[model samples]
Target: MTVRGAGIFGLACAHACATRGARVRVIDRAGIAAGASGGVVGALAPHTPDAWNAKTAFQLVALLEAEAYWAGVDARSGISSGYARLGRLQPVADDRALSLARAREASAAGLWQGRAEWRVVRAKAGWGPVSPTGWLIHDTLSARIAPRAACHSLAGAIRDLGGEIVIGEGAEAGAVIDATGHDGLAALAADTGRPAGTGVKGQAAVFGLDRRDAPQVFADGVHIVPHADGTVAVGSTSETEFADPTATDALLDDVIARAVAYCPELAGAPVLARWAGVRPRARSRAPMLGPWPGRPGRYIANGGFKIGLAMAPACAGLLADLVLEGRDAIPEAFRVEASL
Candidate 1:
């Protein structure tokens, strides 16, 4: 099978195909980890458990399976994906949010299937977000990973499974998949004569910190994730219109400031690097998958948006099942027609 694009979605699909005993070739023009899949802030967080639907349930399943999936990849490739399930913290700003957090604790207990817990707790000093209500919503399901490193590890694992990765150019072989990120969406827009999806540019930064064990923070509309490599990743600025997609500007600076303000431990944190990339976002605001309509032997796997890493495992499995096993388990919301 041939998979185009080497970002998280493409690589994960290739890996899944290879694991199913198919010889696969992954082709990419910009190469692996060069897109939003190479981002710094790799927070594998969840939507509010208060809401339950096909989209939220799909994400929950993927987030729950991420640890073992990444561990298997790491074991096979002999490269660490830098995955850690350290959980997450979100501050309660007011009494209204506090009430909602408490209610969700019960909802999570049922939704999470007793595998995890969501509870209201006091903010941990020096490492937690500032809580105006002196309380935070802590969920044990959230985790963090190094995005670039994860991609490298996944690529290595694919090779170990006898999959070939072709950079620059390659011929299509067997069943074909269009897993290209933002560019694929643009191509679909042109091919279908309609808006398929869009490229949403995001900016993120890594700062020197060693709180690898601390829960990630989501406060003031910013994500602060700590990795195992003694670095904290903070992001991002979502821009739909940009003249320079790869350039980092003052918008990222404001994100950093907010991160430090919410989590005081990062007050003096030195900015190690600023990074930017364009992410594919479908109109449905969900991961797009399944066969391309009117195009036999071709499939679509774009629109991961910000949760590509978290969604990669389940999405890949469903895609492989559809492509190889003749199973059609993909959610209707994730189908190509949902966005097209």
Candidate 2:
């Protein structure tokens, strides 16, 4: 099997196929993790446990599968992908939000089926954003992984499994899967004569702080992910219109400011890195997975938008099932026809 784009999605798919005893080859023009998957912030968060739907249910399965999936990658590769199930904390700003959070605790009980807990609890020191209500939505389902390291880790795992990743070389052999991210989305839009999808630029920053094993904090619309490498990542700016996809500017500074305001403990931490990338957003605003329309021997695995990393494990598994075993377990909402 052949896969295009050596980012997280492609690498994950390649690795999954190899683990299943299929000889795989991955082709990427810019090399591994050169796209949005190269970003520093890796928040494997889930949707609210309330208002459950197909998308939310799918993501819940993915988040739960992450621990073992990443652990397998780490074990095979002997490299750390900085994955940990540290959970997440969200501040309760007011009584209204607190009431909603409490209500979701009940919903999570039924929806999560005891696999994880999404409960309302008192805010813990240095574990979350300041809660005006002194309450927080603490969910044990959330996790984190270092995005860039994860790509390399997956690549190494594939190599160890006798799979190959060629940079700007090799022809598509057997089945061809396109996980080419934003570039793939653009090509699809051009070929279809309509907007299939577009890229949204996101900017994020890393801070020099030792806060590993802490729950990720989401407050004031900013994600504060504490990585296992002892550095904290705070992000991001979702800009649909940006002149430069890879340039960090005042918007990033504003994001950093917001992050600091949310977590005062990070105020003194020095800036470690500033990064930006474009995330693929399909017209339907959901994952587009299935055979490439009007193109035989081709498949697409793009349009992950904001939740690409969180969804990668399941996405790769489903795509591999379809491409290799001819099994189609892709959710109807994620089908390419849905996006079209």
Candidate 3:
């Protein structure tokens, strides 16, 4: 199988196919992790436990399946993908938020199938986001992984499984899957003469805080992720209009300020790296998967949007199942036709 675009989705699909005894070659015009998947902040957070639907349920399955999947990749690749189920912390700003968290505790019990827990707890000191109401939502299902490292590790695993990652374009030798992030989605939008999806630019920054063991914090529309390398990541500014997709500026600084305001412990951390990337966001704002409509021998695995990393595992599995075994377990909402 030839997978185009060597980002998380493409490499993940390639790894899945190669591990299943299919020869795979990944070709990307800009090389691996050259898109949004190469960004610094890698949070595998799930949607709110309320108003559960197919999209959130599918994300739940993917979040639960991520640890073992990435662990297998790290083991086979002999490289650390910086993957850990460290969980996540979210602040409860007021009574209404606390009430919702308490309600979700019951909902998650039923929805998570006893695999994970989402409960309201007292806010911890020295770490975790400060809750104005003294309560926080702690969900054990949330996890984090280094995006670029995970891609490299997936590439390593693919090579170990007898696949190749090549630079530049190549003819499709077998089943071709389009996992090209923003570019592929844009092409689709142009070809269909309608809005399929567009890129949403985001900027993030890495901090020098060595809080690898701390749970990721999501507060004020910002994510504070602690990587395994002892660095903390604070991000991001989602911009639909940006002149430069890869430039960091005041928008990122604003994100850092918000992170610091949420967690005072990070106020002293030095900024290490700043990054910006454009994520592929479909019109449905859900994954656009399955065989590409009206395009024989080609499939789409794009439109991951904000949850691309969180959704990669299940997306790869379902798409690989469709491409390899002629089975389709994709959710109705994630079908390519839905995005079209």
- In the range 175-288, model 3's lDDT, one tens digit per residue, is 999999999998887777778889999999999999999899999999999998989998889899999999999988899999999989999889999999999999899999
lDDT of 2 at 112: 93
Candidate 2 residue lDDT tens string, 1-340:
8999998889988988898999999999999999999999899998998777788999999998999989989999998999999899898989899888988999999999899999899877755788899998899999999999999999999999999999987888888989999999999888877788899999999999998978999988899999988899999999999998999999999999999988999999999999999999988889899998889989999988999999987999999899889999998999998888
In angstroms, the error of model 1 at 276 is: 0.5
Number of clashes found in candidate 3: 0
lDDT of 3 at 335: 88
Residue 70 in model 3: shift from native, Å? Answer: 0.8
Candidate 3: C-alpha lDDT? 0.91
TM-score of each: 0.99, 0.98, 0.98
The residue ranges of model 3 lying beyond 4 angstroms of the native Cα positions read: none
Q: Looking at candidate 1, what is the lDDT of residue 275? A: 97
Clash counts per candidate, in order, are: 0, 0, 0
List model 1 lDDT by residue over 28-100, tens digit each. 9888898889999999999988768999999999998999999999999999999999899999999999999
